[model samples]
Target: MQVNKRPYGYEEQTMFAIMAQILLIGFGLVNTGWTQTDFFPEETQLKTAFTNTPIEVCGRVVDQNGFPIENCIVCLTCGVATSTRADGTFILSNAIRSNQLLTVTALGFYPEIIPVELYLPTNRLAVELPPIILWPSNGNVIRFLFGGDTAFARRMLDPLERAARNEFPIENPDALISVSNPLPGTLRVVSYVKPFFLYVDYPIINFESVVTLDPSTPHWEKDYVYFTLPGSLPAIKTLNIDYVGLGNNHVYDYLESG
Candidate 1:
């Protein structure tokens, strides 16, 4: 290593130094031996030697039926918060050995908190937490209807119309929803969704655009994307969509406008 470095020019040495500094700065924002960041809290206040320890605090979240819960928010009282992936898996690497509480919350289910002790060693340890089950909080059991990605689906109108007529059940639903689409056009195809949106208690959708007028530059992203006309949101307001989660890849499609 010394022999190779001896032949390197000043530019190469300078680049390595900059990279090293960047790495330290990156880690500093999360956790370090001296200070703790809000998003990555440590339990102990001890000033230990600087460690490059790769600790793992991993866990899964599920419903009472043992089915996995997606998009659950898991937060530790120590400061860090992580969301479970589609399969209900999450890992908190900056976890310090602490005797504190870990809170788990989801949209429809009741929130739960569990006691935790996250300890770190010289070597890496995969500390897996227990499966957190979220039961329904409200006594009134609700039936929810869900639909998939509607970005390019101009054919979604018929089903949405059925859902609105209650012909899908003729029975009123507790909640009916669609996800991850921004209303850009006149929406002649899915105007049926408006009625279902107005009827349900939790009128929710995953909005994936800046939801504005005055068109912005096309996103350089190499994936499927869409932006809603600001005028289109009036349709949303008419439907009374109560909640939105920016959990899709294209939420950043408009860059700063996003």
Candidate 2:
């Protein structure tokens, strides 16, 4: 029996075919930029794992009340989002900047973003966060008007009907609002609050001026500041100033007295 050795080119042709197929596959992988998890698990973990960051956190989710909210999703920076246990307990460990915000989002609850340092400190501290109250998002979302930085210097407003109005799509809004330093004046500044209140659900203004006879001054920077009288404050309710916003700028106007 003679051994057959007739194919000289066949071996080289087979090897070349195999090499061509491999080259095609390599080019495809290069274009797509896919990592091989089987070969290098550590590198893949480094790229995709949010848990690898150096902050450890645990917290409970609750309503406005003290009751625990089950199955709420708590999320943090670096994509470290997770679901809470039945007891509203959640744990996450990853390193994100203290200045970054931690977001806790859930269905039927308003998404809230608090500073990451509030929960997980940038100093790599482990913290058990206080139960966060999830505000309801699914109720009747009434759109109300809110204005900022309004300082009415004893000025009466023109009527909404006569004062060339912009055609707003004011449907059934919950309220109309003007905020920060609009005090009720001697000439019926509250007149403005009533018509808007009659048209909508409620009309609200933030009375920044103190209804007081006290002449003590916190206005060290300027002598031009004035406070409304106590008698005038009754006009605040009489004209239907439905709500008041006591923000920092208003409260700081008279310092502790304010």
Best by lDDT: 1
- What's model 2's lDDT at 176? 26
Worst 10 residues of 2 by lDDT: 163-172
The alpha-carbon deviation from the true structure for residue 130 of candidate 1, after best TM-score superposition, in angstroms, is: 2.0
State the weakest 10-residue window (summed lDDT) of model 1. 166-175
Q: How far is candidate 1 from the true structure (C-alpha RMSD, Å)?
A: 20.2
lDDT of model 2, residue 217: 45
Candidate 1 C-alpha error for residue 132, in Å: 1.0
lDDT against true structure, model 2: 0.54
Misplaced by over 4 Å in model 1 are 1-47, 50-54, 140-258
**Cα lDDT of model 1 by residue, 54-95, tens digit:** 355789999888999999988876677889999999887665
RMSD each, Å: 20.2, 21.5
lDDT of 2 by residue, 185-223 (tens): 432555534433433335556655544445364456644
Model 2 residue runs over 4 Å out of place are 1-53, 118-124, 140-258
